[model samples]
Target: MENLGVGKVLLVEDDERLAALIAHFLTQHGFEVRAVHRGDVALAAFLEFKPRVVVLDLMLPGQSGLHVCREIRAISDIPIVILTAKEDDLDHILGLESGADDYVIKPIKPPVLLARLRALQRRQVPQDSVRGALEFGRLVIDRSCREVRLGAQVIDLTTMEFELLWLLASAAGTLLSRDDILNRMRGIAFDGLNRSVDVYISKLRGKLNDNPREPVCIKTIWGKGYLFNPFAWEV
Candidate 1:
């Protein structure tokens, strides 16, 4: 973990005591941390630190977590993981929708948080320098920037949307089973209810202008799963 190079981290928590503890824990784990209570100061510190990642608390004195998340996303694509006291599925999903790369419920142990942050930082690092962006006709996916473009149209996608689309595009024309997708998207033992993945798929299809009735890109493989038709880019 020491080789991770003490990446910069910004923590926005109103609880001063808890903030000190979290800051200490993160520093011990090789992360340079700046903990702030106000969103305004946090934003300023973020620019100064130019952190590789952020740990944002939903409850803030100056700005709501959602507001901060949106503002951060407007300027950059730095991966953000929102901390929330509520464990409701909808709340977590909303967090994802609001540009958060991940969500962690309260009562998280220090080790768990450290592990998740490290994982995120690892993913954020550039894995390929020479590999060209993925191009399927109008849909352009820049692997380096993590951005999507349809023809001349720039599109915004949630984290889950991006992940699902990336998986399908990477394996175009290959059928991926629903269970496999669920595990990959959520986890091997994800406990989400039945309609969660389905809902997300529906939403993604809408963004891609994919018609279920006369499907173009994503097609159902009957009882199997979904496949991204590589040939759709032509028609």
Candidate 2:
């Protein structure tokens, strides 16, 4: 594979051999990769490198990958795909809760990892349908700038969160099932167990200032899916 020059990728892995191999593979597949072997310095490297995305390992020398993920997310919404060695459900949920955009369980398949990275990138790409800014009362969604503003305040959202919001808001009152959302956003069929959509929806609700207990804007349809009520955005 030749480098398509898609974007820069920051890889944080302790193992020298694995890091080198991952870097090489990503570089060949159109990414400029910078491999870092320490979690403590990952943030510094991220700030300096300003990569489009991050590939992080769970275990590190000093700082844990979860801590690194939280720190990175505090400043920027740069996409983070954590590499977790454990297949435990708690580990997976905790990684997402730590602000990681996605997680990959090792031993890693380079192609699968690459696909996940590309999916993250796709969320950042603007769509033709969202030509101009969308306004619902005080809420403003600007597709061109990929920004969402509530009243006078700017809401910070990860790439995935923003994409999910846009998809639902565009449909307004329509109910979007989990399978429907997965297919549209990820270009893949849902296996009925992928909770990425639900996780991101929670994150989006938090950022959007929607009440979790009595959510008015983005509401869950119980067994159906999710619904974005445009009218609920009003004061």
Candidate 3:
């Protein structure tokens, strides 16, 4: 396999041995990996290193990983891939809610981790064929800048959130099933259990100030899929 050349990665793992192993694996695959052991200093390292992606462990010495994830997200739209030992759905949901773009279970497989990282990197690159912003009344999604705005107010979105919104906006007036969403965004077919899409949609709706129960922008089609109402953003 060739090097992806995705660039710097900030790894926050308390286990020294595991961190070294993961860092080594990533380094071999053409990434500059910086491993931090404490959650409290993770933000500082992030600012200094300015990595393209963050691999965070939920359990840490100082602050928790979730806190770090939120802190980093507040300032940057950098993609975050959380590492958790627990296989529970709640933990995964928590990680995604904390602004992480993806989650990897511990007892980690380097290859799987690598694949996730690559997927995120791929999303960061704007599609050459699709250019400019998609404007809908007061709402505007600028793919070139990776920014979204409602009138004069700019909306803050995590990396994954932006990707999801862009996907839906690009296909305005279309009903995208969960399976279609997962496969297009994450390159994996939905198996009726992944709730990441729903979580992200809720977040986007909240940020866009769309009423959850009576959402006009992104509508839920009952048992079918989601639709981006091209006509609903006039307000």
Identify the candidate with maximal lDDT. Answer: 3
In candidate 2, what are the lDDT values of residues 19-47, reduced to their tens digit? 99999998899989999999999999988
Pairs of residues clashing in candidate 1: none
Which regions of candidate 3 deviate over 4 angstroms? 1-6, 126-130
lDDT rank order: 3, 2, 1
lDDT of 1 by residue, 72-189 (tens): 8777667788888987778876766667777777876777788778766655555355255778887887766667888777777754567678878888989987787766665533
Clashing pairs for predicted structure model 3, backbone only:
none
TM-score: model 2 vs. ground truth? 0.91
* lDDT, each prediction: 0.75, 0.85, 0.90
How do the residues 92-121 of candidate 3 rate in per-residue lDDT, one tens digit apiece?
899899899888888999999999999988
Clashes of each: 0, 1, 0
The residue ranges of model 2 lying beyond 4 angstroms of the native Cα positions read: 1-6, 126-130
Give the range of the ten consecutive residues with the poorest summed lDDT in model 1.
187-196
Estimate candidate 3's alpha-carbon lDDT, on a 0 to 1 scale.
0.90
Return model 3's CA RMSD, one decimal.
3.6
Model 3 lDDT at residue 175: 96
In model 2, which range of ten residues has the least summed lDDT? 1-10
The regions of model 1 sitting more than 4 angstroms off are: 1-6, 127-130, 144-147, 156-163, 177-188, 194-207, 211-216, 219-226
Top candidate when judged by TM-score against the true structure: 3
